[model samples]
Target: MDGKKAKQEIVTGGQFTIPGTEVRKMRSRKGDRVYQIFVSSPLEEPPSSGFPVIYLLDGNSVFGTMAEALRVQSRRPEKTGVVPAVIVGIGYPTDQPFSAVRHCDFTLPLPESELPVHPKGAAWPEHGGAEEFLSFIEEELKPEVERDYRIDTGRQTIFGHSLGGLFVLQVLLTRPELFQTYIAGSPSIHWNKRFIQEEAERFAVRLRDAELDVSVLLAAGEIEKSHKSRIPEHAKVLFSVLSELESKGVRAEYREFEGEGHISVLPVLISRALRFALNPGGPHTSFSSV
Candidate 1:
């Protein structure tokens, strides 16, 4: 073949997608916003009890990485301890890796006077729709997914990163029973004057009075501490509180990814998060560069 033709063929590309994945759009009854849902099902028949399900945030960015990882790792479950699962990515109807709408969907309500001022003095995007967003998921999305797939509701997991991570903590504190496991990566705990910490305290009180079975994995990049990001310390403190709840049927663990940064830590976190969700008996604390 001619050099030009060969190079052209080498660079040719088409739309890429995970084999068992499908996309659908649904407008939330709680709001005017429409969400793009990505679902990836394992090709193998599910266990008699049904496949575990993971609800992932920022779907446009990480859905493929996670869905494919589950496909490959679950193949050798005896070695990897990773089981096949149905992944549901909740994202906006946009091509962008993350949508501006997340500022609303991922944050909790705060008085206008208490809102943080933008670093550049720009007006912040609309926010404080987390309650509505959570309702949409519990009331609308979960039911839709259950109708279409055989999922073990008792094994559901929800994962989020950054602002999305903040949302995960909110759900865990206020609605711990909604999902069996919660994974928060480099959570933005510094937001809103560290309001989530207070929520954690409240959750502690509730835990004393209620019997709930749940697990949480809090992870952050080691570089975040060197960069003066509050995530590492915040996560550590949250870890301490959660760890004390082991006797209460709460399984909590923490991980710090070596030689990684805020954005770069995602891929490694995804792998570890999957293992943590599927294998609840893994180590409680660890460090890794992979």
Candidate 2:
């Protein structure tokens, strides 16, 4: 609507099949530098009404999958019984470096680890910019959606995986008002050796007086531990942390699939996680903790 007709393209990736949503490429200036911005929305129905929205991080990997699940799940409301919502896939344009982008976008603080063999090697050191990333979502992206689409402004949810899951948790704790439900799968709680453990503690104390009614669903697979590493152990500790939150009037649920693995659990469990996360009744015993 401004300088030039910003170029748009049709792309397919992530957790959904967004047939009508066209991808628009834009740029954002963070301080002094510019970063490419890519967003997908329904082309035919810009202002889609009665649809809640799901803002998915890592839209390239998980957006289409989640969209497909919502498509199927929306048809059989009797099965999941959850309302279908619009899927906003946030992606990076070709210009930005993927690792640095995610590293700075999803993390909270630069973590210093005592161990040497960390997953994040030395060169790509940008970390802990989640607050800024959330700001981009609330200020830049959400406003665009609201101006162009018919979205249910009040009912929003966020879904993420691994590091993205860590970002979701950070947003929940720091800005619980942004979304009503939170979904995280196989999150890397081992970040900075469970830095989120301490963040969760602060969130619990703040939530007591705030009375923030938020729902969270944490999911990991039974075989996540079989890799002969510390991931499974981290998941256990993450579960304990979430359980502690539940005891503090924060609605939470935990699910560990019997045979699912880390890489495969997203597709396997996203539907159920979405159901429980968005369910208005808050956390319930519909599924077993073990």
Top candidate (lDDT):
1
lDDT of 2: 0.67
Model 2: CA > 4 A from native: 1-17, 31-49, 94-100, 111-116, 119-122, 227-229, 244-249, 278-290
For residues 158-244, could you state the per-residue lDDT of candidate 1 as single tens digits?
Answer: 999989898999999888989999999999887754587788888888888777889899999989997545789988999999999
Give the local distance difference test score of model 1. 0.88
Candidate 1's TM-score reads 0.91
Instruction: Summarize candidate 2's per-residue lDDT along 1-290 as a digit string, tens digits.
Output: 77788888878675753564556654444432233333333333323444567888877666667767666665544445555567787766543324346767887776355322444555545777777777778877888877766778767888887778878877876678889778888876666544567777777677566576677877788888775445557666666766666645567777788888877887877778656744334436243221
CA RMSD (A), model 2:
9.3
Those runs of model 1 whose alpha carbons end farther than 4 Å from true positions after fitting are 1-13, 280-290
* TM-score per model over all chains: 0.91, 0.77
